[model samples]
Target: MSNRSTRARIGRRVMVHTPVGGSRSVMMGAVAAVTLATLVTGCGGKSQDHPSSSAAGNPAIGKLPQATTFANLKNVAKDSGADAAGNGTVAHPTAAVPVSATPGGPPVATLPDKELGGPTWVPVVETKPGWQRVLLPSRPNGATGWIPAGKMHTAHSPYVVKVDTSARRLSLLKSGQSLGTWTVAVGAPKTPTPAGRTFIMASLAPAKATYSPLILPVGAHSESLDTFGGGPGTVAFHGWPQKSVFGQAVTHGCIRVPADALQQLAKVPLGTPVSISN
Candidate 1:
């Protein structure tokens, strides 16, 4: 997996994939070579450490063990809620927090503290008495996991990103007000972008700054391609130098936005909810 500082050159027409899932890197110049890899299964690349089982506690009782993995947990249910107006909440883990399959079940993985070199912020989808269901960046799109709500800090994000693939448009909303909408590129027919609820997992700046000034990786992956450019087929929102690419379904799985749209999206914080609909 590539680190934040990993620099590499990509040619025009090459599918840009971040080394770590949920973090994308793009390069710009005459050649359009990019630095940084694409987003992976988790907000970061595969985790090297696992949470100590000795620290395990029941989430139903408001106690959680140390959290840790992007690969171990699966079968998480898809988030079916509508776009949160102004009450959307994001969670920031103070430490690695264990994720469980059920409220009192054994933990399946741990949530990390950071992703793409930035603080890890996950969107809370559902809330129980002691547990909060959060959207995970792992594969099998729409994957979700349960974490102890008391173990992490929470904040509200008024921003919501809505994408209409059929219309090839992207809209930004703040506090239920429309910020603006712009035409953007979507996934090709062969590699369609998976639609569902996700969050902005990371914001990255490449070394070259040619293709785009910044790459905003979302917590969603490609449905067709398991991997691309040596990274998990993580989808992202980024700017394309060619204005003609906007409003066209030509990308592998990433959303190619216009310069203006990218500028507006850059201000949106990570963990802001993104809703993609067909």
Candidate 2:
């Protein structure tokens, strides 16, 4: 994990991801508009703090299978109800693994060994004999990349989350049963949040964000904003202290939640499904 500045450019504030896991809100709309576009979205300090490892290039492929839509990086066989199918098992990575552009293509980015700390890689979807396609934690949302299967270890999870932009709410479920629900802030009409089947790529605690203690960077991005907070407009599940923002269209593209709601969401494993809809 390199200590690179992961800041983003909001309307006028320069939301910086500090090397110490702290967030610095500097006003740089005029000073560094170009620089802000280069910052990553959430958990600024190191790329390792989040599961969406940095890769240079467009990761958009096409529509994937229904089940393969989200990142299966932490779903184990037993948890995925895979005792029967045995085909859609998610494999966790034992060591740092290199992501490929194609089934057996060149290296795009190297995934750190740690899975945002606890829940690591559970790569399913075998593409070829030696290669497997896993969901990437990148912008333009729902991106997938290939990696060597032999380099990964496997797992599963039974939890899932559903976010409804129309209703401005989020629901958590386990084995299809509701655990909890909460109001949330979505993107403004001009900067709509990218929807579809995504997953929790990482759980991060910003060193200095006044809103909440944690942030969950999802495998989605902003459809309108190209580069936000210096990153690739990557959408995330984060907290906002402002109560008024709840149940409203106020964010650049990220989903904003109350602090209490964010605590519960942090418990969910990385790579768990995060289905967002309009």
Candidate 3:
């Protein structure tokens, strides 16, 4: 674990998770103690530690999708063709392999020889031959891209998390059935929690000075703020010490859960689906 300085930027009004109103900006005052693995991606206002660039000379890829309407941003049902969830390691013939905008499409981002240990990704339901369409842990809430299937590895998770912002509730499910539910704290009106499909990219525990022992960073970001708590506006599922925060709209953009709720959620494997709704 280590410490780092980061910058915060102001953003637009968004009613993502729970509806509460005001100007939502990134919190930049605190010096957060973060795990080394987490620092590679979500920390310091950066999403991925791997450097990316456009690829060239690849006829095996196809066209890229528009950022405005990225497919797979909506609900990811239990059987979304994403049979497994796991971290990606670039095992291709070369470093800086192209990540397509769509399955078998042109490159949108490139992967490095090694990832700085980033988030988990789910392959798209219907993938092209030899290519896997995987969700990315980047901006715009729900982003997906394509990577070579042979270049990655994954594991399955039966657990899933569904959050209802309007009701201020968080539910844990195993194989589509509810295991438990808890009241939670969502984003305030100005910096409302974003709604969409995302996944647990990483499981982290801060060394000190935090309310929660575990932090589940999702593949989503705060639509209202550019950064918060030294992160690149990455929305996370975490716990708070105060019971008063639960069932309230009072966070920058993170889901504030209870201690007991976090304990149960801990059992969920990394890369599990996390759906947030209005």
- The per-residue C-alpha lDDT of model 2 at residue 209 equals 60
lDDT of 2 by residue, 1-278 (tens): 21113333234444444222333445555336535523543333323324344222433311111111123222211122222112334566655566666766656455545544554544354457888766555443555667786777766666777899989999988766888899998877766777776677777776766456787877666666444454545678887756877898867778888777788788877767677889
lDDT of 3: 0.56
**Model 1 poorest 10 in a row by lDDT:** 1-10
Return whichever of 1 and 3 wins on TM-score: 1
lDDT of 3 at 266: 81
- lDDT head-to-head 2 vs 3, winner: 2
Candidate lDDT values, in order: 0.67, 0.59, 0.56
Best model per TM-score: 1
Ranking by lDDT: 1, 2, 3
Instruction: lDDT for model 2, please.
Output: 0.59
| Model 3 vs. true fold: TM | 0.67
Candidates 1 and 3, the one with greater lDDT: 1
Whole-model lDDT for model 1 versus the true structure?
0.67
